[model samples]
Target: MFPMQFALKRGMKAEMPDMDIARNLDIEKPRSRSNSHNEILTKDIAGALLDVIRDLKSTLEDSRKSLSHSAGAGCRCSTTGTTLSTLDEYSTSGPRSSDMMGIPPEIMSYVRTFGHEPATASDLMDWLTEFEDTMEILGLDGQNGTLDKRSVVARLALKGKARKVVLAKRAWLARQGQQLSWAEVQKSLRLAYRAHIPEHAMESRLCRFNPQEHSEEGTGLLIQRVLEIMNMGESHDNEYRLFYIISTLPDDIKDILLRRPCPTDEVELIGRVEDIELLKVSMAMNGREQGKGRKR
Candidate 1:
């Protein structure tokens, strides 16, 4: 054992160059990284791996194309059990569909800001589309099996202004053992809350359109809200709307707009308002930069 150890040591010494063993002892050999760093490197490696994977993908795609007689195909498997794409579409590994979760604050904000007024069918549809967009972004859509088309409609009736007639009927159905769907709830809300603004009411509604006084946010949001309410009244005269908006502008923005030579055209006038306000923002930024320079 001793002779074998000596022979092996001598062979190693003869074959290898001289080493600064003491200096190297403090030099870190590559230590195992933290899980986060490993994940980052793993993603980089995966990105590079995609090129090779794409070639394999293209071959299978081409083969599928040939099978379908050179016609294009759907991404997922059809009723005939043919899928023509990368493994990612078929991959059931990694995270489960339900395990994935993302809920934007906008959806919660929308949910919270209900019961303010009776919405028209048009208004409700627009609101539903927005909230649905957030749901889709969050992966809480029908495809993920976490939500259905009717789920959004049901949610609206459950939360806000439609809660009186729409929600009451929904509760009544539940008690009566009638299984009502989201579409049914949505239809009910439209019937109950669709606003038919009379000729006289339009002016009154327009007059009542006050800007939201956000303590934290300044004139930008107030101006935006005023613009939004102007659109909401459904009075088709853009010229009237434009001048009315100009007349109603907050003091700071109005002062800035008044300084410019106003365009006779209402469209041009509205354009000038937006353009000049943006200019003022740039001017303010320049002022800040000059102040910073002076301080320096």
Candidate 2:
């Protein structure tokens, strides 16, 4: 009887080790290489999504170019053999004849900067607000209006129904905490015209800009104006510190005026004063060219 009891106890001890090994395997399973692959899988999915969005945007723009000249005849049918209905059927209504005029070059430039995202009316308003804030930091608000952007945008968006739609959309986005792209904003403007949103609400006290008279000249103007403000400060550090204040501009502005474009001209102008390495080389090259000109 004693020998049998000892045999049973040894067998139970052997099985206990196997149970611990199984428990450890279960706990550590998620740490396997398969889990590591999930991060890579997520990145691939994001890349695919962006590519699809780009394709959709390209198709939309191509369709717009073709249909804008069709004179209300409606779009051409797809390969599926169904007639493509007028955008008005899906959208609000046909745009008025007057609404077919030209889009501003600055507006076009703005939209092109965003790549493939669809533009909406709200995005244009936000851009106006952003640019205005940038100008304000440079002390370029010659009109000295209130700093409230909603008020400012409402006043500047005065181009008729388009402006009104932009303002309302912006207001809605602001309430919803949603941001729109420049391309999206432009798309919304075109779509709004089809949707038959009334043009009357657009004629607000704030939506009344005349760009020829009120526009900031260009990027150079803003830079020059900012330098002037910096020059007025008492201490050298105070002048240098204005940069920290300007850095508060949104990331979108930074992407445009700072990152992609590199602000080469602006940087070169500053390099003349600061004489950093790249700037020094550029200035030396300029000097050599000028000397050759003088010799001629």
* Backbone clash total, candidate 2: 16
TM-scores, all candidates, are: 0.22, 0.17
| Tens digits of lDDT, candidate 2, 156-222 | 2222334445556656665764544333443443445335523433222112332222222322233
Candidate 2 has a TM-score of 0.17
Poorest 10 consecutive residues by lDDT, candidate 2? 8-17
List the candidate 1 regions with Cα displacement exceeding 4 Å.
Answer: 1-206, 209-218, 225-236, 276-296
- Expressed as tens digits, the lDDT of each residue in 1-296 for candidate 1 is 11222221221121111123212222223334432221111222323333323433344345434434422344434332545342322323212221111112232232233332212222333444433332222232223232232233233223333335544654565566443443444345334333322343433343344432322133454355446655555443433434444444443344333322212233444554544344345345456766898999
lDDT of 1: 0.35
On a 0 to 1 TM-score scale, where does candidate 1 land against the true structure?
0.22
lDDT of each: 0.35, 0.32
Superposed by TM-score, candidate 1 places the C-alpha of residue 51 at a distance from the truth, in angstroms, of 80
| lDDT accuracy of residue 118 in candidate 1 | 13
| C-alpha RMSD for every candidate | 27.6, 27.9
